[model samples]
Each structure stands twice: as C-alpha cells, then as structure tokens.
Target: MTQTVGSRALSSPRELTRVADRSSFIYLERCIVHRDANAITAEDAEGTTHIPAATIGTLLLGPGTRITHQAMSVLGECGAAVAWVGENAVRYYAGGRALTRSSALAEAQAVAWANQRTRLDVARAMYRLRFPDEDPSGLTRRGLLGREGDRVKDCYRKNSERTGVRWRKRQYVPGDFTAGDTVNQAITAAAQCMYGITHAVVAALGCSPALGFVHSGHELSFVLDVADLYKTEIGIPLAFDIAAESDEDPGPRTRRALRDRIHQLGLLDRCVTDIKSLLLPSGTQASEITVADSDIDRVSLQSDHDQLLPSGTNYGDEAGW
Candidate 1:
C-alpha cells in the first residue's frame, strides 16, 4: 500500500550525519529532520528502527516522516528509491538508479526487451485463460477477431455499460477510447501499488525500474509491465463493481474497497507464482497447476437459478479442449 501525508506538520528538524563508510543507525522522532546520508540507521516512535539500506528494496515514507540528508545520500549510494507520501497520499519521490557493473545503458536495453516479451506472453496467456473455449485463430479476423485497439475499447464500453457510469467529456473523445470510469479508477489504484512492488522487485534483481522491457515512458515503464497482466481480468472487473456502487466518481474509499477486492480476487498472488515458475531454472519443473474444483462448483451452484430458463444453460460446457 502507498503512504499518505496527514495534516500534522513538523517544527524543528535535525541535520543528518553521514555514515558512508561504516554501518550506522539513525532514529526518527515525531519531529526530527536530517539530511540525506550515505548510510545511517533510523528508529521510529515505536522504537522500531534500523538502517534500511541493508534490507529494504524500496523505502516509502509517509507525510510527517523526516529523513536526514546524510541518510538520503547513503540510501542513494545503496541504490534505493526514497518515495514520500503527498498530502493526498500519493507517492512522490526519487532515486531509482541502474547499478550494473556492466554498461548501464546496455543492461537497461536488455532488461527492457526481456520485460516486454514477458509482458506480451503474460497478456496472451491471460486472454487464452479467460476464453479457453474460443478459437484463437479467429481473434485477428476483421469482423470477428478483435483487434488490440478495439479490445481496449470494448473493455471500456462493456465495463461502462455494465456499471452505468458515464465518462467525462475530455477524459475520452470520439474514436479515442479511454478506459471507462470504473476500470480507470481501479487502474489508477493498481498502478500505484504495482509501481512500488515492481520497483522493489527490480531493485532486488539489481535491475533498474526506469529501464523497462516494453514500456518506454520516463516514470512508468516497470509498472506498465505489471499493469499489462492486471488489466485483463482483475482490474477490469473490480473497477466495474466499484463504478457500479459509486455514483460514477470513485473516491479514496472506493479505491481502497477495490484494492481489497483485488486481494480477494487472488490475481497478484497467482501472477507472482506464475512468474516465479517461469523464472525458475529450466531443469526445475513445476509440480502442478491446481485449481480448486470446489470453487467451480460453488459458482455453478450460484448460477443454477439462471439455468432454469428455456435456453437450457449449456454455458459452453460442451466445448472441447
């Protein structure tokens, strides 16, 4: 979750001490400010403090949280991004650097390519999973097969129609398909969480988040990869529900609710597991890909009422694998 700044402000702050050469700890009180340091320790009001440079992949500070210049410098040297929560709880800060021993540019390019391919593969897999009975060969036909541009548009339309929400005039123009209100809000929330998570993962792997495989935008490459996987099912549906409940405008509470729903949807956990399986060395085989039949049964039971119609409720059950 991203941090947010509250109304409380600080009074007097202290100067940060440099600890680049040695392992040092710093403490943070309700009112204490220090300069960025090369390496220093820190403690919170609860007495829970440490030199995070050694362990944290990304450091996120809430509003009212203060750091010394010495600590900031040390964090930068250690290749950590210090993100701060704004008054609106949005995260804003800097310090994601490429720390490869090889040429930074070359490493960034390689990573970007690999990440792009990975994202595409994941997108294809998710589409196939969502529509297992549909013929893949027909997906590209002009009249029947849905194009990427059209698919995005259809996703917006279907979501908006399903939720009864209208898009702001400038939010989307004629022929310029923007994600609908529900999906857009959900996307924003997911994007925020995914940004920090992807950055953390990239940092742990000694890669730069700015140098993404498929994404080229300055501040969003890595998060873009994560979003590509999320939008297909999880974010789309969750956003639709949120839009349905709210009178079209989703506030922070709605975003929080959608976030909780995403957790229940299990997309992140499943995606992480799938990625881990893909990244494991070739020799290591995944033991199993299991889906609980009980869950399917529960869904089927819940939908039994609609099956009573004259249509006979086949629901694609006869489609062959």
Candidate 2:
C-alpha cells in the first residue's frame, strides 16, 4: 500500500526490488555500523568501510559487531533484515523492525489466533504446507505434535544414516548451554540460523513474532512456528553433515554449513513465499481499510482531558471500538 508521512499508517515498507547484490553478507569482525551523513558505514580498527544500505538483503551481525540505533532505523527503512547473534554459536537473539507500514498482517494474525477453530485450521494448514507429503487431516493439536515429534526423530535418524554420524539419542546438557556433544552443538547452530532467517522473513511480512498458532507463551513463538517447518529439511541435514566430518567443534563449522545451505536453497525467498501463502490464503485479499470517521476524530480529540465528562467517557463520545 502506498502511504505518506501524514497517513495514519506508522510506516511503509520499502520496495523489495531495491535488494542489492542479491545476496546477504556477514560481519564477523568488531565493527560499528552507524549513520554517516547520507550513507551507512561500518568502522573498525582497520578502517571505515561503507555499507551498501539500500541493496543488501540480510546483514548478519556475529560477535563483536556494534550497530547504532540510527543505523538500525536506516536498515528498517531500507527493508533490510538485521540480526544480532548469540554469544557462542550464531544463535539468533533479536532483530530489527519490518519494512511494512501496514498492520493488515498483524491484525489478521490476531483475529486468527483469537478464534480457536480458525487457529487450529491455520495450524493444520501450516503443517500441511510444511510437510506436503504428509496428511494432517482430522488430527488434533496433540496429534499433530506427536506426529511432528516422530517426524523429527525420523529425520535425525535418517540424516545420521546418510551422513554416517552415529545418531545418538538427541540430548543436551542444559545447564552448560554450550552443547557438550558435537551433534547437539551442530543442531544448536543450525537451528539458530534457521531462526535468524525465519525472524527476518517474519519481520518482512510485518507479523508478530510473539503471537504463535502452535507454539505460545514465549516471545518469538511465531518465529519458532515458522522455523520448525524447515527444521527437518534444513537443520537436520546441515547438522549431521557437519557432525559427520568429526570437525572437533561443530559451532563455527555448523554456521558456515548452514549459511551455505541457506544461500543455496534461497531459503529467505522461500520463507517470504511460505509466510504469505500460509497467512493470506488464495483468492483472498487482506481486509480493506475502513476506519470510521468518528474513530479518527476521537484520536484527535483525546488529547484534551477537560473536554471529557467526569465519568471519563468523552462528553458526547458514542463511537469507539
């Protein structure tokens, strides 16, 4: 939707065609990305390097990268995905805003989530979309969970056999967080990459990461929902392949392997398409904007408390949600 600064819509998404290089880049060195006059620049011990703010797709920040608030705002406006990584592995910790100004997707998400039947239907659709070969019909949420878990185990076993990396039962030492085992560490690394990509896509579509259909309670629950779709397909293979190499430490190797896989599969584009397809069903347009005239006036008049009656309802206010 086209918009102006004066419009009620808070922001407008930038043109996706503006994506430069057609590829994303990672910043591993300690550098600061900040606004410099008309452009964004990254400065480090070596020297100051200019960032092509308008063209790049996702700008990944590994350890030791510092980004200014202004730079983040610039990236948001540019419709570029910016990700902050975890301490040990390149785990996705947080992300910047989406390019979209429209609230259509978010509102649609809320409406679907608020309705139990619709939410389950959407969940079923998600499962079917992710696993096209599998049948998800007539399955309850718990049933879906059980099936999904079985599929995951199957994937681990299948990949282990293919890669010849003795698939031990999936286990992790929780208190350490740093995976003691190579397979666990590889899995952790791969999952975070998927999360990073999924988070970027979620932001691009202007959906809320906190509101999820299957998974809930935690923030980035929606992100987890979307990323889980590719977990078996992407994460499992990548982790096992890396672990098969007996690569001493799976953290860095997993990051490299996952990045390559993400690029090769064009996972980001797939993510965008999957989100829109799942959220916005075929032949159905997002709702039309029909903000009431009274609603608009109420916002403009709410600033003056004295204009309202003592009961707190505006003197003659009848129009509200």
Candidate 3:
C-alpha cells in the first residue's frame, strides 16, 4: 500500500496543481534587464522573463537609469524599496510595506523622540569633550552652544559645491526625492548605503531593526538609531568630501571609500549598552555578557547554535552533548 502525504491524490495526474511561490528576492548590480524601448527589466542571470515584482525584495537602479510606472507599481505591491543611482542617489519608492499606517506612525514617533534625546545627549557629550575646563553649569546656561547640525550641513554643502553638486535644504521627511545633481546624488547614495549596512548589522545581531532609543519603531528601529548617530557626525561630512573629490561618477569605489571612512571614524566601535545581556557559564561561575564590539563575533557564533541547544545552554555544554 502507498502512503499519501496530504489529503489530495498522490498518483492522479489530473488532480495535480502548481502552487505559486511569492517569496521576495534581491536584484544585484548585474541582474538588471533593459528593453528595446529605453526601459529596463531586472531578473536573475538565468534569463527568466517577466520577473515577478513580488519576487523582488529590493531593487537598486544604477546611475542614469529609469523604470516604468508599471514596474514601479509591481515593486510597490510586492513591498520593495527602489533605490536609484544619480547625483543624489535616492530611494524613489519604499513599496507598500513602508506606507502602512502602523509602520508610518511608529517610524515617525521613533525618529522624533530619538532625534530629541540624541541631540541632547550628543550636545552634552560634545560640550564636555570640547570644554573640559569650563564650568558645566555655565555651558548648560549658554543654551545650545554646539552647532553640530550646522557644521554637518555646511561641510556637506561646501564639499558638494566643490564637486559642482547642489542640494536642496535638508528635508528630514522620510521617502524619496530626486538629486539635483551628481554631487547631491552621491551624498544620498552614501547615506542610504550606510543605512542598508547598519540594518544588516542589526539584523545579524538578532535585534529589532525598528526600535531605537534615538529612533523608535516596528520598522528599521535599530537602523534609524545607528543612522542617527552617524549621519550628522560622519555620513554628512564624508558625503561632502566624496562629492568634492571624485570627478567621474562615484560608483562602487565611492561606496567602498565611504564604508572605509565609517570604519576610520570608529562608528562601529561606539558602545550601545542598552540591550539586555545573558549570563554565561565560566567554569562554576556565571557572568553577564553584554553585546559590544569585542563580543559581537562570539555572540554571533553562539546565536547560530542557539537553535540546537536551549536558550540558557552555555558554550561548554556543546562538548558534552
């Protein structure tokens, strides 16, 4: 006797049905497809036609490119972010998921609250570092002494202008906008690149991407937090310099340089100790291990093994079991 896996017939050819898979995937630089009518279609390298927009998780359109409304709609329906390359490489669209009401509210609240707190904290820290000999009360009474935002904007503007790029006023509003020139495009590209990288880092650490002390929410919380910390301090300045220096269009090379600058600025080295830590066994003793740069690699390894072992299982337990 033959056994059946489900309620349906196993041997009947006429009863067979094809199930559609709507999972999303990403399109890399080389996976883009172009049309004879000055349009482009993107898919995997296997030459599959009519790449379902739903299958696309994210679409990165390189510099000097365009997409049709139909394609954009498909991507939107499928919940994908369309990142374009240009002077201010911008996110043209953030798909359906980005526009959800709950997500929007959460994101807005997170950003606003985080921004306020971050501004205060950053100001205090900068004040202490800049004027150690000065009285703290005097600095507090001075009322908004540091001009970090202005410094960032001015540095960015100068660098952009040097590269023949001009940007409109900094619009903190979320979503996509066109870059006025190559310089503006470069700055936007660098910023988004940092955002993506930071999001990935937060995901790898098993932390909610949306839900930040400086950035709050159910979507991109941690990414927003990390971006808040770096954008004004590092990203803005780097974008300015990159815009000013590179004569030709800055592509992958520019991205690499930007990432290198982030590292040079020690962005990742900064400690975020707000997250709770788990106690780990060390011989007969247990110690609390917080997530930090030094412990990131070790924690990542342990996280991988967490599925096979219980939540509280220690590193040494693996050897016995």
By lDDT, the best candidate is 2
lDDT of 3 at 243: 57
Considering only N, C-alpha and C atoms within 3 Å, which residue pairs clash in candidate 2?
11-101, 13-99, 20-55
Tens digits of per-residue lDDT for model 3, 1-321: 342212322211111100012211233454545322212255545662444443333355665444657666644433444555434343332423331211222323334345555434434543444334443343341353344344556666765566555666654433443423445555566677766545433432334455554334447655655654456556665665665676466445456677566556544334122111110112312112222213112212224554433344457655554
**Per-model lDDT:** 0.44, 0.69, 0.43
How many clashes (backbone N, Cα, C below 3 Å) per candidate? 27, 3, 16
Worst 10 residues of 3 by lDDT: 11-20
Misplaced by over 4 Å in model 3 are 1-28, 31-151, 154-168, 171-178, 246-253, 263-287, 290-321
Per-residue lDDT over 254-312 for candidate 1, one digit per residue giving the tens place of the 0 to 100 score: 44664455446554345444443433334544332111212121122223444423343
Highest TM-score scorer = 2
Tens digits of per-residue lDDT for model 2, 158-228: 88789888877877664454655778888977776667767767776678998898899989889999999
After superposition, which runs of candidate 1 have C-alpha atoms over 4 Å from their true positions?
1-82, 89-146, 168-186, 217-220, 247-251, 265-268, 276-321
Tally clashes: model 2. Answer: 3
